[model samples]
Target: MKKIIAFAGSNSSKSINYELVKYTVSLVDDFDIQLLNMANMPFPLFSEDDERKYGYKNSLVELKEDFDEADGVILSVNEHNGNPSAYFKNLIDWISRLERKFLEDKYVFLMGTSAGKRGALGAISVTENMLPRFGAKVENVFSLPEFNMNFSAKTNTITNSNMEKEHRKQLDDFLGKLIKK
Candidate 1:
C-alpha cells in the first residue's frame, strides 16, 4: 500500500488544524496513513547556534526518514500572526538542516484552517509557495474558515453544506492525483 504522512503544523494539543487534517485523512481510501502530532514529538526552539553546538537530534533524523519514505504528505498548518506557527516553523528548520530536499518529489496535499474568516490563508499561501521550492509537488490546497462554526467535533463532520462540498471536491482531486501516481 502507498504510505501517506499526515500532520498538523501546530503544537497545540487541541489544534483545530490537527482535527481538520485527521478528518480529511478519514475521507481517503486504501492508503496507509500515518498521523503525526507535532506536540507528541517535542523539540526545542531551533537556532543556528544550537545546530552548530548540538548537531541534529535523533528525532529530527527520524522525521526526515518519514518524509523520505512516504509516498505523499498531508499537512494542515496553523497560523499565528499571519505566519506559520513557531512550532511548525521550527520543525521545518530542523528538517531542512538534515535534508534540504526532504520533500522532493513527494505529492503534498496542503491545507490550513482557523477559527476566523481568513482561515489561515497567509500561512497556507506561504507554505504552498515554499514547498514547491523544496521540490514538493503540491497536489491541492484547502482552507477551512470559521472552523468552529463549520465543523462539529461530536459528529466529525462539516456542518456547513457548501463548505463540505468544497472540501470534498478538493479531497477528491488530491486522491485522484495520488491514485494516478
Candidate 2:
C-alpha cells in the first residue's frame, strides 16, 4: 500500500482543517494514511539564531523522513488572515532548511478550509503560488467554504452531496496519479 501523510496545517486543538483532512482521507480506498499533528512539533520562530541554538531536533528530522518516505501528501490548511496558519508556515520554514525544494517531485493534494464562504481559498491560492518554489508538485486542490455549515467534525464527513462528490473526484485524481507511480 502507498503511504500518504495527511495533516492539518494548524496548531489549534479543534481545527476545521483537521476535520477536512479526515474527510478527504476517507475517500482514499487503498492507502495507509498517517495523520500528523502540528501541535506535537516543537520549534521556535524561523531565525538563524534559533537554527543554531536548536540544531534541529530528532522529531524534525523524522518528520522530513516521513515526507521522503511517503508516496504522496494530503494537506489541509487553516487560514489566518488569508494565509496559512503561523504554525504551518513555521513548519514549512523548518522543513525547507533541511531541504530547499522540500516538496520537489512529491505529489501533493493541497487544500484548505475556513469558517467563511470562501473557505480557505485565499490560503490555497497563496500555497499554490509559492509551494512550487519548494518543489511541490501540487496536482489537485480543494476548498471547503462555510465549513461550519457544510461539514460536521463530529461525524467526520462532508454533509453536502455535491460537495462530497467534488471532494471525491479531487482525491481520486490525486490517488490515481500516486498509484501510477
Candidate 3:
C-alpha cells in the first residue's frame, strides 16, 4: 500500500486545521495514512544560536524520517495573522537546515483551514510559493474557510454539501496526480 502522511501546521491542541486534515485523510481511499501532530514534532525557535546550543532536536529526525519514507503528504496549515503558525514555520526552518530540499520531487497536497473568511488563504499562498522552491511537487491546494461552520467534527462530515463536493473533486484530483507519479 502507498503510505501518506497527514499533518496540520498548528500546535494548538484543538486546531481546526488538524480537524480538517483528519477529515480529509479519512476520505482518502487505497492509501495507508498516518496522522501526525505538530505538537509531537516540537523544535526550538529557528536560530543559529539555538542550533549551536542544543544541536538538532529529536523531533526533527522523526519528522525527516516520516517525510522521507512517505510516498505522499497531506498538509493543512493554520494561519496566524495571515501567515503560518509559528510552530509550523519553525518545523520547516529546522527541516530545511537538515535537508535543503526535503520535499524535492515529492507529492504534496497543501491546504489550510480557518474560522475566518480567508480560511488561511494567506498561509496557503505563502506555502505554495515556498514549498515548490524546496522541490515540493505540490500537486494540489485547497482552503476551507469558516471550518467550524462547514464541518462537523463529531460526525466527521462536511456540513455544507456544495463545499464538500468541490473539496472532494480537488481531493480526487490530487490522488490521481499522486497515483500517476
Candidate 4:
C-alpha cells in the first residue's frame, strides 16, 4: 500500500489546522496514513549557530526518514499574521538544511484553514509556491475560510453545502494524483 504522511503545521494542542487535516484525510481511502503532530517532535529553535553547534539532531533524521518513506503528504497549515506558524517554519528550516530536496517529487496536497474569512489564504499561497521549490509535486491547494462556521466538529463534516462540494472535488483530484504511478 502507498504511504501518506499527514500533519498540521502548528504546535497548538487544540489546533484547528490539525482538525482540518484529520478531516481531510478521512476523505481518502486505501492508503497507509501516518498522522504526525509537530508538537510531538519538538526541536530547538533553528538557527545557523544552533546548526553549527549541534551539526544535525536526531529529530531531524527521524523526520527525514518519515518524509522519505512516504509516497505523498497531506499538510494543513495554521496561519499566524498571514504567515506559517513559527513551529512549522522552524521545521522546514531544519529539514531543508538536512535535505534540501526532501519533498522531491512527492505528491503534496496542501491546505490551510482559519476562523476568519480569508481562510489562511496567505499561508496557503506561500506554501503552494514554496513547496514546489523543495521538489514537492503540489497536486492541489484548498483553504477553508470561516472554519468555525463551515465545519462541524461534532459531525466531522463541512456544513456549508457549497464548501463541502468544493473540498470534495479537490480531495478527489488529490487522491487521483496520489494513486497514479
Give the per-residue lDDT of model 4 (tens digit) for 1-181.
8899999999888888999899988888899999987778788888899899878888789889999999899999999999988888888999999999999989888899999999999888888888887899987888899999999999998899998888889888887887884
lDDT of each: 0.89, 0.86, 0.86, 0.89
Q: What's model 3's lDDT at 78? A: 89
- Tens-digit lDDT string for candidate 3 (54-164): 888777877888888888889998898899988888888999888998887788888898999888999999888888877888868888888889889889888999888
| Candidate 3: pairs in clash | none
- Candidate 3 versus the native: TM-score? 0.95
**Which 10 residues in a row give candidate 3 its minimum summed lDDT?**
36-45
lDDT of 2 at 29: 77
Model 1: per-residue Cα lDDT over 34-65, one tens digit each = 99988889888898999899998898898899
- Model 1 misplaced regions, further than 4 Å: none
lDDT of 3: 0.86
Deviation (Å) of 107 in candidate 3: 1.6
**Model 2 bad stretches (over 4 Å):** none
Candidate 3 runs further than 4 Å off: none
TM-score of each: 0.96, 0.95, 0.95, 0.96
Candidate 1 residue pairs in backbone clash: none
Q: What range of 10 consecutive residues in model 4 has the weakest lDDT sum?
A: 172-181
